[model samples]
Target: MQVIDPVTLDNCADEPIHIPGSIQPHGALLAFDLEGILLGWSANVAQLLQLTPTLNTPLAALALPAEVSQAASECLDSVEDGEAPVTALEVTFGAVRFDCIVHAYHARLIIEFERRDTPSDAVAAFALKAHAAIDRLRRQKSIDALLQLATEQVRAITGFDRVMAYRFHQDDSGDVTAEARRDDLEPYLHRRYPASDIPAQARRLYTINTLRLIADIHYTPSPLVGRAGDVPLDLSHSVLRSVSPIHIEYLQNMGVGASMSVSIVVAGRLWGLLACHHMAPLQVPYSVRMAADVMAQVLASLVQSMEARANALLVEQSAEVRTRLMETLLHQDEPARALLAHAPGVCQSLQAEALIVTEYGKLVVHGDIDPELAARMVASLPAHGQDMVERSAVGDWPEALRPALAPWAGLLALRFDPATDGWLLALRREQIHTIRWAGRPDKVIRTGPMGPRLTPRGSFDEWRQMVRERAVPWAAAERLAASQLLGEMHRASVAKHVETDRARAQLLAMLGHDLRGPLHSINMAATVLQHGGAASTMSTRIQASSTRMERLISQVLDMSRINGGLGLGLTRGPVDLVPLLHDLLDEARTAHPELRIDASMPAALVAEVDGDRLVQVVSNLVSNARHHGDHGEPIELMLDERDGKVLLEVRNTAPAIPAGLLPTLYSPLKHASVGNVRNRGGLGLGLHIAQEIVQQHGGEIVYRYAASQVVFAVTLPRA
Candidate 1:
């Protein structure tokens, strides 16, 4: 047996585990060029095939059976360029039958030959077992359940003393998540192993070759030989590839004489491993290994589906929360207050302990946290680069700030503006617990011929450590949700600013157009009257312009007072609608003589209301109707009382309001007709003020389009 000294083993990371230069003695490996010129052959090949390696020797000279040669050619042709090995082919060479697995690597055709001599009965039995195992794995609904089922099924099929399902962590380290073994053996479940245990090259090999078995650690490696040169063979896809000496030593230290590992691949990446171990040298049949490989593939597919489904659901939920938050923020005047209002929902939905929003030197915190410390941290955080950062452990944070953040171990933060120090941070509290490790996980160095070499720890005994100041790691879903929240917040802030700027511009325009224009006309008319030029006409124009200016000013004041929370100061009294309607009809006829006016009402319909405010509501509604109504269509008003409620309808023939603009019709200062078919503009508060007054009287004003007519409908309690 060859014992690699500590120096060679120490450089395990640089070791080319893929090109071991040798292979297990039980199988033969052959490498040839595209023209059938023999390039390389394992030392065991001569004994197995009665052929020796020679420079530029054609593979056909060996006289391999026609069927076997054709199968080999077909296998190579079927494999696409740069793809993994194709399925193995059963072939006969003399009296020995073998499974011929062919693949191309670095412009060389490499073939592995594994001897197969199982009886027909054994083959049939193994097939049944393989099918049962696949069926059992398929029934598992979740990734965890599937892994557990895989471990148990592989153990039963391979008959190994211990079987464990090990999963890789984000840091390349791995943990034994599920295990099934003999009752007397120690359990390896939940035990974490350092990344160094499996070298980088070894991990790459695991992805290429899904199943690997070491039937006997003590068996000698048969070196591949060529006619000339010192070129080594590449055994990357060889099932009977020789084991790495360092790995052999590690297994020996752990009292494992034989082992088999099957890679669990998800979405083309190595996700984990199903490792089988035995205390004594044991040979696992090729059939059993094949069955284990099939099971691993099936499990990998199921895991991918489950994860995809989970991610979709999380995305949908995050979108809903984002929509709700944006709607609330758009309606708010202050961003800080808006975020505070939805703080609880945000925290709960994100599964966070606390939430913080810091902007422009202002800090608002929503849950358990040290406000002063959080403020300091927020100020110190980067104001550029990545928009989001998530960390499960904050141990590397500054020592000065550690005490303040000691209670929390995880953080998810999103910056709304990369150029500004504005952030939305979600916090997670620290979790302290005990964890079991397979060993001390500390690398050891030993003196060797070449200075020293790093080696795996000598002990496999369980080591218990108390883990502290570490919170539950933030999952990909939570990070995605945080990103979505930041996007929505940014949009809301932009929209609010736009709306604010627009409203300000509109107010300025109202002062310039409605107030200034009318006042200027009146002033010009007064000058004309003073000069004795058409005094009657100028005087009439002055009176009409002044009245229009007064009405505009009064409406502006009413909207301002209502928005400022001032009560409308209504005096309840017995008001007669019939007399009021008749007076309003006469006034409308005088104001808009070109259009006809229609009114429907009871002879004596009376209700308790503020006579002045109710009259103002009616006046505003009637004026709006006359201005926006079709030029040739009559304006209609209907008022009635039933079931202790007063119903009022103002209808006119006009183009239907755009669906998108209808919701904003009752909003203060919103011009629903800005770009519509009719653009007669005002302060845009006529319907707004009317709706406010009716609500004060315990009523609602609704606008709807029906039968080619636009209608303003108000329903009020008779109070």
Candidate 2:
């Protein structure tokens, strides 16, 4: 009933599993130097090969089979350092034949002789079986199907009693996802095993060596007899490397006499394992194990493909949701409010239960989340440079917030604006579920001949536990989607800021130049009246200045309303264009005596329209032409009907607008600077307001520049 000490359990991770100092009893190992002199041999090599071993003896003097000697020489010549063992040749000793596996390690040529149990002709059969298995696996459309097929194929190829596909989780624990076994054997599918079952060092070796076998768990380990000062031989890549005693005891407790594992590596990481177990001692031939290894690799590749495809589909869906959210942000005056309105959809896309949006330290939550708890969670999150932070376990959160966050164990926080502390957090409620572990997942310390050592648990009966205070793990696709949404939010924020700055600069410009002119004229007229100058002349000047100031104020108000998502307040009525045009021309002529204006129109042309709003449109267009047009050329106005629609065209001779500025030509507060001819005494809202008024009347306004002439045409549908 002794429990392992915490320190000793931590020390287990540093075990020298690679240099085990021995080989399994199924094989005999021999180590030689470059000069063909024997350096080390396993203790049972004399009994296995019937050849007495001698230290510092030349290999040729051992009187071994001629083929074995030649094959060992060729292997030493061709094998590179640190390479995995290669099957060099097959030779017979007395009546039994063995396969020679050779590799070079640390200036020594090591060879392992494993008994050849399968007939030589079985090699071709194994090759054909592998090809068929891979073809069948390729036909599977999902990871589950592929895993099931893989386990079945490995069992079929190796004749093991049980084969299970054990997939590793983010926590390093594993679950048996798929299984193929004899009818009398108990099922292990969906059973979980703790990370401590496979220590860190053993997992590292799994990545280095793709296949490992324990032919007989009860067999004695043949100790290597090397020179007095030599270090323990590194069996990291050895096929016959002895199994760890802890692992051996664990397998024995499970009633497994033999076991083999093929590593499933994806993108250079150990993704899972193809674990095979037999009820009795089983020696699988090297050729057959190679076939199983190939299948395992194929399974890894297929799993990767299936996962990538699913993730891609999720990303596409998330992008659609993001596009809709962006539209809301751009159209509404308050972006945070708009986002909160669509919180449910966002949460669904992110696979979360609730959403929290924070702007300038104010929190707005959608769903059944408490505002106080949400605030605490946000405050407790450490400031990170990354735009997105994801946490699934309660312990992963800051200690101060863990107690409050217990109910909501998962968090995906996207920081859209670091300056304003704006964040969009998606939360998942704690999901309490039961796990069926193969055992209690605890080990004990036992004092044996090797001193105090950590031993595997003796019992492997099914054990169930209820796990709480943890949420279901988030998928990679969800994180990717969150990151993408963060990027879009950042871009939208920058655009909003740019527009704000531009409007601010325009407002200052108008206040300094446009309004000051009228103010100065009114002031001068008032002073003259006060000093007893001609009252009629001073009154006329004051009236003109006051009218100009009123027009500027009206234009500013109109722009503000349109920008606030409010359309123009238009009153519809029928109005004749001929008189309106004539009267407008008379005023323009009187106002600018040095300018020439020309007009053409059909008599009595009229339509359903907002008369006052139409007047503003026409007046703005004429004033824009006068200010920006070439002064030497006559301004032309035409009123006519075309294609059953009323067409009003205002033409002026001016240089074409710059290409870069054309896109923003009708945007509020954006004006063109053409060769120092500034927009004299007017805000840049004329065209934008004109477009809005025309559209409100079910018409469209278009601008064209051709042959040094700028034309703005309003097309109104005839009622």
Candidate 3:
């Protein structure tokens, strides 16, 4: 055998692994038609069969014994569609004994004759060992423990120097989760391997052929001799199929002489593999291989059950936490406080070092975190809950926040509102660990005739690297708990507001009715004083106070009526909106000489609306713009008519409405701060009244924030 160059060997990975067209010399293969005429045979068949068989020769003409021929035909008939070749029967012809396996392939019956290597007495011992392994597996309760037991049992049964349970990640990369090996050998447990190490074709073959055995890595491949014009054989399910050259080279690089792998399948999918490797060339009897296959299947079933149980426990714990948190929130006066009250249990449930709850404009800290740092982390969280749970290393966080967050190396932050600085942060302290790797992960390349070629790394020596600036990974359970917590918080918040609104409405109605008589007397006294001109300055002050009081009282009555579902009385007429806007703009310019107002009005746009109500709506919008608009930019007012509807838009380059404030912008008594001035308000009812009046006239009012500007758009029916 010649050593193939690295580039050529690497390219061989692309070759169809299923159709190797060769078999190990320990086996002889023969292909025949359904009518029992020989179509093809392996090159070594003559040596095994002790006869020269012509192509297309009928079964009756061949020198094969009657029993072997009958068994082959029956096995071929028993093979279902898409099923792999199976050992049908054993036959001894002229002192040569073989196990004959028959399968259907491409309109032909393929029979494989493998010489049995195991003694008859070994079968009973292997069966007993299999039963013991299955009993041990049944006693295990967790997937990890079961995997450990499985690898040990396989190593004990096969007498392999080392056995490992390799589990794959979602990306096809694998990790050695469990290992049983000689004391002198370096451990491969928890060592990771890239997906490229096992090419896609190799993975597919593992599924079709659940068990593969390479007795000797350096064995020569015996070619199969097909009839004239026959295609290469597809030896995908062949027990004696020659292994890939690249895989053999890989094993050699790992200082392995022989290797065997049995696929662990769950729910009809390949879950992982029980991979066994020996320090020297070794072969196990086929009986042991069959027993190992059964053990792997049992392990697969147990693993699935254990994983499901673990998930169920997690869900149960999460539900309990959610229930307690909701109960606390529903009864507590302060929702943020309620979150803090449940912090200890939630922290334990989520497996976090600390938990932070930032809601309702208050920051609540739970454990092992700086209040300032937690606040910053909450502010940095995105507003959307779609990616509500963000897990990252502290070092990877923003540079400004890194120092404060560094102590907690891992951060898992979830936001109830992506548009607001309200979130829940789970922190995990910095973790440091030393990882022992099987070999240097770096690829070794050769500058060959091809620009570059990859070669297997030389040594399988253990390499250690100290890793830091990271945190223990967030588990799936923690993420689930966080999502559940967020949902409960949102529900509680809505319920709180609903209760608050109902109580407030009742108090307002009582206050409105009680204050009416007293307000009437004050108005009468102010009117009398103004007419008599007694204490002229006092008279003027009294009249202005009375007027302001009357406006407040009227707004309260309007709110009460609206809340009671009483429709607003609207007196509609064809009113020209252009003139109304111009008059309002003029009034605005005169009232605020320091501000600039830009107006674009159509010549004449009439709409069916109450002239008084429309004027009030325009006045309220203009006033808001003047008071809350950005000081550096002019307010823009546009009125136009198109497609039988009137469009009135009032836009101002203002400090944008804060995301947190947008939801309450048009709610009654919800005051918005203008620039830096807070509470510069006239009861906060201006926008609310304007919205109600517009809706009554069959119009729609909407507010939009764009380019650091606030725009109020009103669409109404044109006269």
Candidate 4:
């Protein structure tokens, strides 16, 4: 006896189970290239087929039965057309008949021959049974009903002791959702199995192969014989492929003599399995297995259809909720408050117990949950690169926070605005339950022929485990609905902001127009008093105040126009900026005598521009610096040319703007504070208007801060 290496949990997943270089003893395998030269053959082929297979010799020369030769030719034609394997041919070898299945893989044609014990007319009977089973499955209304019926029908067809409808969870673990078994046998329904029982590679193979059968778990394997230099054949698509040793041991430990699995695939993914087990060695006919495979396919299709219908219903319900939320948002001034007010509808739509909306560092929760605990949970959530975070178990949370959040086991969080740490969270309270498992999932390390390693448990008794601190899982449709709700909320919030901005602009326009007439009267009165022997100081002061008021009104009107989408009107001409800068600096000195200003520029630089608009830009920049800059430091203004473009830079010594506020700095009506003091007597539209004017001139303006110096640089084409 050969001493094979022991299988351990660490290396079991890596075991190359697909290419076992052998076949089950019940069947014989032959491999030949497209040119008909034999490449490999199972050791049992001579006994099963009554002919010896010679390496590198034409299969025709070996004198296979005429029926097999003809079937092989037809199968090759179908394989060339990209069709699946063919298994319709049966040939008589002496007195016994054999079923021949053929497929093409890795540039080789593989033929499998298995003894046929069924009647010659079994195919017609299977066809009728399959049609009736499919009709019954299609008539079922619900997925549960369909799956239950499917298990029963598969059990009746295969005559297995037990038939289970096993569902794979998102974590790859399995649950026997439905079952059909002999009345005397213990039930395996509602039992859970750990994911390690089916390794990743096995799951992948299941997806590709659709059906697998082990006729007799106690039977020996017939090894394949090939040339010395040839590699192990890829038996991924071979029907007679040998079983993995570890899997055989697993089934033996369970006292299962025969087993088969029919994959339930949906949308090209392995959704679940129809697992059949027999206590005695059983050999199911090929026709019967094919019938079970058809039923599973029908079940997969029906499951897909039912799930789609359910998801569509969820989508419609969520759409209605979103519409109602939008209407409320339109009527109310605060979006977050309106959403919270309608939280019940939103929560029900998403199947959540509570809804929490976090906006601008404020939490508005609407449900039976503690606000402080919700805040802590929100703070502890790690950033997941903009992906939605869904959890159903307390253990899925951070270890330190798990104990605190033990009472709440489900969390679905969507970050709506990452800039403001805005998030929408849904929570569900924990529900404790008990799970029945086939056995204790923990494998035991036992001494084997090779060494001590992990082995399947010997006991087949039921094991009950108490599960706590977990909630019912969120369904796929629920996740989709939550994502849609978040997106719609964002859109509604943006629309609300636009509506508010427009309303503010209209109000400003009206206020600025009304103030202009009064200012004109004040200016006229100041002019008359100065010339009519009044105190020149008083008249001058009145005139200066009126002039300042008029400029403020002009700024107000400009902001209104910009916010209203009517941009500033400009008159273009060539203007000398050197004198303009000097006059602006002189005016600034007269306005603030205590503040120092530094200037650097060319003697005379001419550019085509709206001189008044350009001055407004320069003045606003200077004023903004004075208001926000450190009073103890000097403000520097520089004008120069670079790379055939005119450059204007205004630098002020001050701390850089907060990173959080920088993104919305130039938004209209936004105010920033410097050392806890708000901007000095302005509508907070200086930078916004400046940027608008610069962009209209086909130029760009950018803000940069370094070493406590804030710089606003404007680059304009020299033309």
Q: Return whichever of 1 and 4 wins on lDDT.
A: 4
What is the model-wide C-alpha lDDT for candidate 2? 0.83
lDDT, candidate 3, 1-719, per-residue tens: 96755564345356577777787777778777777788778788788878787888887788777777776667666666634356556666568767666676556677777776666567558778888989999998778889999999999888899999988775576789999999998788998775667777888888877999888888787776756125766777777778776578789998898899999887666778999999897767676788999999888888888877887887888788889988777654345556787887777777888888765445778887778777788766655545465655766677787766667877777665333245777788888787655677555666656455565556667777687778877766677777777787777767767765764774465446545645665666677776885566655556555655666677777766665446467888888778777887787787569889888887888778899888889887877887777775898888888788888889998777777776556666553432125323266677778887887777879999877789999998875
Off by over 4 Å in 1: 1-11, 82-84, 91-97, 227-229, 396-399, 417-421, 507-719
CA lDDT, every model vs. true structure: 0.78, 0.83, 0.75, 0.81
After best superposition, candidate 2 residue 72: deviation in angstroms? 3.4
**TM-score computed on alpha carbons, candidate 2:** 0.72
Q: How many steric clashes between backbone atoms does each model show?
A: 1, 0, 3, 0
Estimate the Cα RMSD of every predicted model relative to the unseen true structure: 10.3, 9.9, 18.1, 18.3
Runs with alpha carbons beyond 4 Å of true place in candidate 4: 1-10, 80-84, 228-230, 381-387, 398-400, 447-452, 497-719
Whichever of 2 and 3 has more lDDT, that candidate is 2
lDDT per residue (tens digit) for residues 1-719 in model 4:
97766666656677788888888989888888777688889999889888777889887787788878887777676665344465557777888787788887767788888887888687668768878999999999998899899999998888899999989887787899999998988898888887778887788889888889999999899999975116788888877888788789999988889999999999887789999999998888887888899899989999999989988887898899989987776654435556787888888888998888876555778888788988888887665576478889998888888878857999998876564466888899898888787888788877778567677666657898898998989988898898898787777667766766675775476456545655776777667776784566656766675776776678778876754446688788888889988998999989789878999999999888888899899998998888889877999999998888889999999989888776556655553531125453466567778887897788978899977899999998767
Candidate 1 pairs with clashing backbones: 10-454
* Candidates ranked, most accurate by TM-score first: 2, 1, 4, 3
Residue 476 in candidate 1, Cα distance off native in Å: 2.7
User: Weakest 10 consecutive residues, lDDT, candidate 4?
Assistant: 671-680
Better of 2 and 4 by TM-score: 2
Report the lDDT tens digits of candidate 2 across residue range 1-719: 97745546666777787887888988888888877788888888888889788898897888678877776777667766634346557778999888877777666777788888788888668778888999999999888888899999888878999999999998889999999999999898999999988899999999988999999999999888866126677778788888788789889999999999999998888889989999999999887888888888888888888877877888878888899988767654345666897887788779999988886555678989899998888886657687788888888788878777757998899999776677898999898999999988888887788667788878778899999888888876787788888999998887777776777676777656777888998899989888998999988888888888888788888876765546687877777878987998898889889878889898789888887888899999998888889877999999999998999999999988777776566766664632124566666778878987897787989899977899999999767
